[model samples]
Target chain A: MLDMPFIRIIEGLNHTLENVIAPEVESTLAKGQLFAVVEILKQISGRFDHKHELIVEDIQVSQQMLTTLIETFTAAAIDIPDEFQANTETIDATAMSGEQLRQQRDRLEIIVSAALDLLNSHRAEIVDAQKVEHTVFMQLGKNLFRNMLLVSQHRFDKISQLDKED
Target chain B: MALADNSRLASYLAEKLGGSELSISKEWQNTEGWSMETFSLDVEYTKGGNKIEQAIILRRQPVSGLLEPYDVSIEYRILSALQASKVIVPETFWYEADPAVLERPFYVMEKVPGDVHFVTQNSDPDYRLIADDDERASLAEDFIDNLVHIHQSDWKSLGLDFLGDPGPGKNSALQQIDYWSDVIERAGVRAKPLVTLAVNWLRTNAPETDQVRLVHGDYRTGNFIYQHSHITSILDWEMTHLGDPHEDLVYVLGALWRSPAPTDWVCHLLSEEDFLSKYEQRSGISVDRDKLNYFQLLLDLKAVGIMATAANAFAQNKTEDLKPAAFGSILDLAYAALAQHLNERLSSC
Candidate 1:
């Protein structure tokens, strides 16, 4: 957190981000955040078409371990748990000044734009490959994101009501 | 070759200019990807009583990267070789394979202009939309036509065979699998479940490709340049090797393509019929659904391996490295969903 360049991948972390985004460009950035969250689950459910089409061999291992090294894997964390510790500290969660936030968002925009380019290309690739129903999966991703926004809005709205009472 | 005020790199570029009075301007870390730092430099000088201004790209390998050797010399060789063969690539100016000057091998290349991204952040309509269906059909044909030119090109003839990694006994896929599996295994606790399953699948049902073809390992969107609906150049040949052409094909048109209309594939620009028709005409090969489907899975496997490896490096703290990190880490997640989809489609087998 102390580092000047410790940027988080706010979005564009996976193809799911691409799917969640493609149709909703006209939507508010607030809604974009919701779709971003739901995309994680949808991506989990998607698989590679040719799962076992390559081969790996190593004499040192003596056996085809066919396993991902545990140390390198990161478990997905999505519950938005009541409290959870970050691997590294998030010292300043407080909002930044408008200019600072815009700069951050501007950098993020570039990263996100690259992702959209990739997604557009990927959309073509999937369609060409005939991996899935084009509209079904991609639109499913978009619709799922829309629902995600609805759910997130509900949660925030309840919080707002409680705040008014306080 | 040298960026503004970075004395370390300035000295190195000075060596490449062959004693020319090299002054550097506009040097800044690209801060782009998670694999390597890309620096842009403006080299100004007089070559023959005429002033010359050249914009170049310098990629310095970080402490750790997803690709090995990270040799700019190799890239220079590969690009130069491809240029000779009618493939579009950034022109290589100078390369230093030696690790002395910059404490790492680095290369400088002339920067090619034009937008490489097909989609803008604004979701600017795909450039393919510039043409009507018939014209779009031709563009799609031109796209695959380039690919056929690539696969049919003689690797030995082009001098790129030596630029890649090959195993002692096994073919390219096995070598790649072995390499990536090792990466995953070395990742130890960080290995995702999907990768393990994908590896097993890759091991059991390998594609039966015998003849070797040059594979532009990451031949997909975000790796090519286009101008006015023309495919300008193919970029990011970092994972080049000898493998099955289907590997490149499936990768080029993998799940990367999604459509507003379910049937309108071809990355939402060209239709599948149009793209494949062009490929068949250019490549002179017939496709079998089963085999094609298998290669589709291989594309995902390769992509996921890359992401997993990148995430591992980032975890290890090579932050300056630019490439996708945790890029498709959810690929573990995607593979699971896509597996069920693939299995259903392959049920006849």
Candidate 2:
């Protein structure tokens, strides 16, 4: 959710190609090709947005984590702040737009993170602190696994064009 | 600004070498390095009525990328200090801080001749990075030896105190945590819950380092160069600093650099047990499993910082290079890896 938007990324690519790369290119054919690619990207920019379902799914996962956190706090007799509960209640995936859902998810993430910090600070006072911590870690692991499935394998070797001889 | 200007570079070299006529015969920027802008310059010049040819390397700071706010002079000084030591490094020539010259701070050094293996080179069925057994053994020996030498180096005698020692006890661990944590914050990324959890865990459980030595901030397989069966030089000292020697050991054992299943070799040269045994035997420092586990988590945290930094650079339109963009795109993968590691460690606890 913290990643740059697809439209902004496209804009960046076009800007780099036109401003940074085009003037340095010596061959007319290659320069034209670069511009063509820029044009193509511009044409496709309006049609792309981050997948809505992914953001919704991420929000759902975060809500599940907050629920578990609240349950743990209650079981331990630890006080849960009103703001934490308020943010958790605001996460209605059906009502929010994609960007709104993303922002809401990000807000919940910060609150949950603050809760974990508070939990660690007073770990001695809370019974079964380590067990609750384990549950949070497992939830995080599940979220990570879901996100990772969408990422394609990286070809870092091609990034630098080191394999090709000039 | 242009990445490199051959004519301007040749003129600068001519004045430095006391040569009247000098020219850059060939020059190529090495894009392989993600941090510094490295250019290999083939120079031909006349000095004292004699014609001389030299292969030189120029490392310039990028506008922005991974490990931002760079100062190439630190790396230059490190290489210069190691010239008389047992560590084999490229000989430093000169460092130029005047941005008018190359549009950025850069330094010149001797171009050490050898082939630097990239991870892509390991395409065999078993994913062996070094296909030749004898060659792998020889390179492995040099790799361990160079690391041991680096850790055993006398920083005070070498006048490398400019790198700043972290003093004694747990300062080394605390200093690194502060360093990477600051990097992530500066990148302007929302702190992920996993990163926050890891940072808290690291701060609470930092190990003590009794003896501090010069740690090669990046000691790994691809960072070294080899010719035939000998490792000619250790490259990429950008991250060099004074810290725990175990930091380097953990980096060498990072899963990202190791060969995949079937081969399962650390750095594609030796088994994990073999690497540890050799390092222990040579360095006379027993490996601490507890500290190693601590550093493994720290390493993952460091990766997240780096990836976030790269992504931030691109998001801000600070650099024209797409490589940083590509690196930033993989931030999720980094987070996932760190999250998975945190789960395993917490589960064991």
Candidate 3:
């Protein structure tokens, strides 16, 4: 599992809270929250197992979109500056670790974002601006959908369970 | 050091109040919120030949937080200015900027009875649950009333001109953009194409503000205390600043803060239409849809900026608390929400 190492630490804390702290705790608030911590830890441990895959998938999607954004701008007869052309290469997700993948994706996103900014600023002057905007929106929609899917998979309801003691 | 414990705090307060016979009846540290260390306590003391008791809450800046470091005095000043305003806020007593008083700067305010209800993620029994329809309705009205009062107040006349006058006209929107942009840049998170696009969009379509009022930058649910279905006090003014009123309205009406309730109540109390209409009717300011949309994007960017800082703090081991780490995990969600909003606005444009 991607989170195996971190999961071990969480498990250790959960074990201590259950066996050590909960037994010695006097106040119900502290006791209940300790147990809740254990529950949250368990949830996080379970979630982290697949989080690397999710990250990898997101990176792959972003990389593809970065490439597409460049192509779309080119197709729209938009001048691609030399600096903005940097890091337009496709990233091989399989060869990189999750951290490396994130780094690579972040680098690629920076380039694409510059391109987006250029396009947005010059959009009014472009005759086929709608086409360019549509392509950018489509790419953004892919990322947004991926993000929503991943977030929906989260087991912990941060809103409902976070302020119980307040 | 736990300098805010019961006896130590009681001793400090006794001296501050110019009294001798003083004792703490209750004291406890609140472990919520990643920004500040909060301690709620009750103090009983003899003052001017009379016995008196008061509940008080103390807030201190932590060693590490989710935003740029700030002095507690700013919050104190804002609260002090609002004391005579229609905005319902707790009474402030003292502020200690010197780190010698405690490990960090701290301020004390009245410990208003009632608890902030965060129904989305917590099930704590301490918060007063509003099951009665009548009570819920009453709380909603009060919530709208407070917000309107804040937006309508003459902040310039309240001696709050220190909060940089965003000049005249649309300087409010531009000023807000500059402020959040600086925060996001300072956060030093990995740049995302989405945030860049959103920021540009904000700049491209910044709105004009006719009036500049105190914008409760974090005006949403979980920031207010309620008792008997009444909002006792509006809390957490650390992010308070002078800006467009629509900014606060956008925060209140944002989708991110919505509960799972039917009609998806704005703050688990009022419907969106009701909230907007009540605000307009009460404040006498018409709701500007374009301004709201622009500020909503700004708010989303602010959320991402904060998450970036939290994530950076945790990744750097600057804090051991899990709250910042937890907040970090939601960065993706904020990004997605921002991207979605951008797509919607751009597509329509």
Q: Which candidate has the top score in TM-score?
A: 2
**TM-score order of candidates, best first?**
2, 3, 1
lDDT of 2: 0.83
Residues B1-349 of candidate 1 have per-residue lDDT tens digits of 2333366666667667654566776665544333455677777755556667778887666556565435556656777888777666788777766666666667777767655433211123443423456544544555676778788888888887795536333355676677666755554321332343345445545656656777787765456666656667777767777777777776656654434344445554566666777777778866556666766666655554555556555555444322434342333443444454445443433
Clashing pairs in 2: none
Q: What would the per-residue lDDT of candidate 3 be over residues B1-349, giving only the tens digit for each residue?
A: 2455557767888998888789987777775455887887777899999999988888888766587566778888888889989889999998988787777898989888887765353233333335677988998998899988888888888888888888668788888778777777766643566677677777777887887777888887788888888888988888888888898998898775565544477776778998999889988989989878888788888888888777666555566555665676667777776776777777777
Best-fitting candidate, measured by DockQ?
2
Tens digits of lDDT, candidate 3, A27-136: 99999998998998899775453345666655665656566666766766778877555565455667876557656656666777677777777777666554565566
All candidates: TM-score: 0.60, 0.94, 0.83
The positional error of residue B55 in candidate 3, measured at the CA in angstroms, is 1.3
Candidate with the greatest lDDT versus the true structure:
2
Evaluated on CA atoms against the true complex, candidate 1 attains a DockQ of 0.03
- Off-target runs (Cα >4 Å) in candidate 3 are A1-64, A68-86, A91-99, A121-125, A128-134, A152-166, B1-8, B32-34, B121-129, B256-261
Docking class of 1: incorrect
Question: Which runs of model 1 end up more than 4 angstroms from their true locations?
Answer: A1-166, B1-11, B28-36, B66-69, B98-100, B118-141, B163-172, B189-194, B320-331, B345-348
